[model samples]
Target: MATLRKRNGRWQVQVRRQGFPIQSRSFRSKADANEWARLIERQQDRQELGPDRKALKSITLAHLVARYRDEIVPQKRGSAVETILLNRFLRYPICQKTLNDLTTADFAAYRDQRLKEPKHRSDKPVTPKSLKRELSPLSHMFRHAVVEWEIPLRNPLDGLKLRVVDNKRERRLLVGELDRLLESTKKGRNKLVAPIILFALETAMRRGEILTIQFRHVDFGRLSLVIPESKSGYSRVIPLTRRAVAILEALRLEDAKPTDLAFPITPIALRLQWDRLTARAGIDGLNFHDLRHEAISRLFELGLTVPEVASISGHRTLAQLMRYSHANQETVRTKLQGPETGESSHH
Candidate 1:
């Protein structure tokens, strides 16, 4: 049974069933109210009214995100970043909508808003790459809610296509650039910056991995470092070059504890020092992570197979390794100009 009444210049429709809880909604027009009541009655008759509908009516996207941040994000590798992104998502107007009320259009609107928003400390709008990162946690949260939390709703993010513009970097270190950068680091306040930059180039390790390295993880006898955990969530042994070994040996403190970090600086301090050092050196458009790209390219130039380079770089896929390996034009030209071999040379 259903009842339609006018309240405060609005049409209110209420549906009642023998076994289900009462359903009610307010609409601007009588026809809209009647339609909603009819739909609820039909759904009830078909026994399609599930607990998910009731639960969704009471739960907001903000609540879901908060639960996800508390229970799920902490276990992720990039939890810190995920937390920040999730917080931003919670502040959006879409978060006010209940899970059952959320639609694909809402997410599409959110995506458009994110694209139009300028990046912090920059005039440029947020890149698609950044939007993708922000969306990843939200998508996962929806999955967690539907599958794990038993929230009865389809993921609104599903089928919503993101127009991601590829901005994969191919920046490689130029000749004499590393030397000048290193010299500039020596003039800075932090003495560790030069060695950290050199180590990144030598070992091809990420900034986090480099900072997380401890004395106990290094095996000088084998000339390798055992990374217990990396961004890939797997442990890998990286072979140390002579220069890398020398740098580590020189920095090793006689009275240092086994658990003490080889590079004790925080990531923020490292970035600050790097900025100062680069500015002093007059280096532009170069990033510390670019050193990893430079190192990977050097590994390829040294005649190492793709799999072999992947082992050192901790890249799981060949495609990923290829993205980091940007061979310089000079190197490519040298290879092209090398002596011809086999039957072609005999002619």
Candidate 2:
């Protein structure tokens, strides 16, 4: 049953049932209030009043993001970085709207606004790759809300097209550049920078993987390192080259504990030292990650098959492995020209 009354020049409706909680709302006219009350009463009488429906009626996207950040983000591989990204998403206006009321158009509008917004630190327009990363958490949050939280609404991000372009990086190390970089690193504040760069080039290991290596995880006899934790959530063993082995051997301490970090440097410190080293070397546009690319390409040049390279690089698919395999143009040209056979043939 619903009771209708006039309160301060507005119509108020309150519906109460034997088993359902009292639901109330205010409307400008009595007819509107009656209509809303009838809808609620009808839903309740049909046994359709669920906790999910109640949550959908009251919870906002901001609340959902908060819940996801607390409950889900911590369990992820890069939780610290993800937490920061999620914090930025919480400040957007789209998060303020009720989840039930969110539509695909709202997400499309947010995507456009994000593409137009300049980065806070760089003051440059955010790239499509970055915007795609930012959208990942929101998309996952909506999926979680639907599957786990039992929210009765379609994900607004579903089937929404992103307007930004994705440009894949093809940067490779040039001849003589490596030597200059290594020489400059020897003069930098961090003496370990040179060896770290060399290790990355030799092993094709990521910065995080190299930094996180412990003494216990390394097998000097087998010349491989066991990555106990990785971004893919699977442990992999990376074979070490002679140069990589020599670098680790020189850094190994006789009295070092099993849990001691091999590199003994943080990612921030490595990045800072790298910047200084690159500037001193007069190198431009070469990121540390490019070393991995250079290494993978070198493996391919050495006649290693895709599966062989994938095993070493820990790449799950050949398609992903191909992204890192950038053969030098000169090398490709030489291969295309073929070996010089002095015998002249007349056709």
Candidate 3:
């Protein structure tokens, strides 16, 4: 329903459908207002523009994941690996439930079930952080479907208490860990892992960034690598350190085809190779992402300010990088040392 009114010598229409609030707009003429009213009336006849209107039926989580994988993931930066992780971790039993049916109890149950899965029995259970990452695609899909596809949502995740993630627990390699890792990488199962390890150590780059590196993107003369699209949605110039430059020089002389990847490998294979490297290194529980933390930690230790470190690391926020800048007690205690203390052996 709509009614035309005159206000300040102009015509306006106030339109409403059942269960929906009235929507009013000013117009230059009564005809204009009447035209809008006619349009709303037509929609009302078809029950499309009324407050009683309902959105499309609720979709199962599995359906949403499939749609997201096909329509959304391809445009993302780490879509391939992210899709794999999401499917591997979030699929099966839980995916059968509709978005509205995904209660806090379901999330809690899923977390507990995932933590106890037999596949991870030999290793530490899936941490809350890993679980959260696996759930990210669901949140994204729900939000998109609500706004774009007009799917009515109760936001199944709303107010569900999430586990506190201790990012600090898993970031840096301890003393001798790096050296042992390097030695182990030499004997790693995959030939590609060794070069990848060397590059990661030198450049402090993310796994996807390193794997996506194209020879043409490397500016040898300038000793810079132009990352066209980083996680920050901006291009970053990775200025090579002398060690990094040396690695590049060696890679530049390799006999591979020009268009072939510098490290043509899947993340699953890389993870398997890392497992072998860690076993041989006599180390345990280190993920490849820790290499990024190691690089950022070294930068701060060498007196590079957070902003300076962010330049090479492609971190957009100091708050984010601060998590990786966790200096050990020795480093903190060393900072506290002064001439007044006369360089004591212990704090």
Clashes of each: 0, 0, 0
Residues 1-347 of candidate 3: C-alpha lDDT, one tens digit per residue: 68889999899898865434467898988999899888877665544653332222246778877887888889876787778866775556877877646666887777788766644425566666777777777778777765665454545665556676574744578899878977777665567777788789778898878887877787778888888787667889978877776776676655755555667787767877787788788887788988887877777787877788888999887778767656544677776874464566785
RMSD of candidate 3 to the truth, in angstroms, is 6.9
Predicted model with the maximum lDDT: 1
Better of 1 and 3 by TM-score: 1
**Candidate 2, clashing residue pairs?**
none
The lDDT values for all models are 0.84, 0.82, 0.73
Stretches of candidate 3 off by over 4 Å are 1-59, 89-91, 98-105, 118-121, 253-260, 324-347
lDDT of 3: 0.73
Ranking by lDDT: 1, 2, 3
Q: After superposition, which runs of candidate 1 have C-alpha atoms over 4 Å from their true positions?
A: 1-51, 183-191, 268-282, 324-347
Candidate 2 Cα deviation (angstroms), residue 270: 4.7
lDDT of 2 by residue, 226-251 (tens): 99877777889888887888998899
